[model samples]
Target: MTETHATLPPGAPAFPPGRYGRRREPRRRRPLLTTLLVVALVAVMTLVSVRLYRQYGDPNYDAQVITYTGITDSQVLVDFRVNVPEGGSAVCLLRARDRDGAEVAREEVTVTARPDQRQVTTQHRLATTARPFIGEVVRCRPPA
Candidate 1:
């Protein structure tokens, strides 16, 4: 009987005698300064995100569809509520949807500023191509 074995070059270090593969040392990791820098970057990004949301993301005002006040064959009437800063006005998008959830009409309505009140209810009328099943206030924002 004869046995055959793989061999290494004369000057090369052999693998550990009893192991199937060479042992590998654990990889080095970044130092504390690099980790802290990444953490600081993430914190800064989070702060900026919150600041931007507060500035332009509807935090200063709120809008809600109070009720579907009325409807006609070609128009929908909605009563919605808005809360705004004192003396600030809000422009709202009122939309009407049919039974299939398709938007039948959309209208932009503006609520006048009321320094004496923070919340107000307003009516909006949207013209539709078909009969509307529901009416809603889609969005409201400060006038540009």
Candidate 2:
């Protein structure tokens, strides 16, 4: 029913001068604005990554799940080992998942190291809404 001047063939018949509407000028690109937006986005992401790393990504405190047992409709038993600074303490994240890989429960547990000990082992019973297939230690970080 209609076509733009740019899309018409050279010999294509044209409508009357004022029958339709005038073609507007093409939009101009703003490289500077785009560059500024990109830089700002990168800066914000870097800041967030740094903040998260400081809060939850400490290399000194690490935890691993040793074994999971006692799985039932209402709860699961999680056995884990965590390594922290000698004589220091850490807070660890514990998670439980159902057979379908859906998270069933999560909790934070605190662990401490003895004067000459850097590794601490513990177990926790996590109450869940559904039957859990596995339990794990997500991470360990410095106590808040």
Candidate 3:
């Protein structure tokens, strides 16, 4: 008696009558490493920009009394020189307050770019009978 092998279906490759080897699939790619590198670079650049801005753009101001002359009706003409960094402008607000901290008079002035010039010439009227007035000069930069 003789032995017979089973038939394979259509379009199927017949097994070779010899030793067999295992097949391997294609390798997969990973994206996690690339994404992490980009995030790290952005964080480093932001820190560098903040440090540079703090160094160069800082503002410094100096105020000096120019003159204090008396005006009529007991008012005084107080002149001041506000010096700011070159090419920068200053906004000056003059305020007169009474003993109770209430605002009696206020004035606003703008000083433009001048290396050596006066900025503000303000006048405050003191009450003849009520209370003595205290004057204050506040200077700042205008909002962009």
TM-score: model 1 vs. ground truth: 0.68
Residue-level lDDT tens digits of model 2 in 52-110: 98877777898889999999999999999998999999999899999999999999999
TM-score of every candidate relative to the true structure: 0.68, 0.64, 0.40
Candidate 1, 47-144: lDDT as tens digits: 99999886668855688887885688799889888888887888888889999999999888889767788887887788899999999887788888
Question: Global CA lDDT of candidate 2, please?
Answer: 0.90
Candidate 2 Cα misplacement greater than 4 A, ranges: 1-49
Best by TM-score: 1
Question: What overall lDDT goes with each candidate model?
Answer: 0.82, 0.90, 0.56
The deviation in Å at residue 67 for candidate 1 is 1.7
Query: Number of clashing residue pairs in every model?
Result: 0, 0, 0
lDDT comparison, 2 vs 3, better candidate: 2
Consecutive 10-residue window with the lowest summed lDDT within model 3 = 121-130
Off by over 4 Å in 3: 1-59, 65-68, 71-74, 115-132
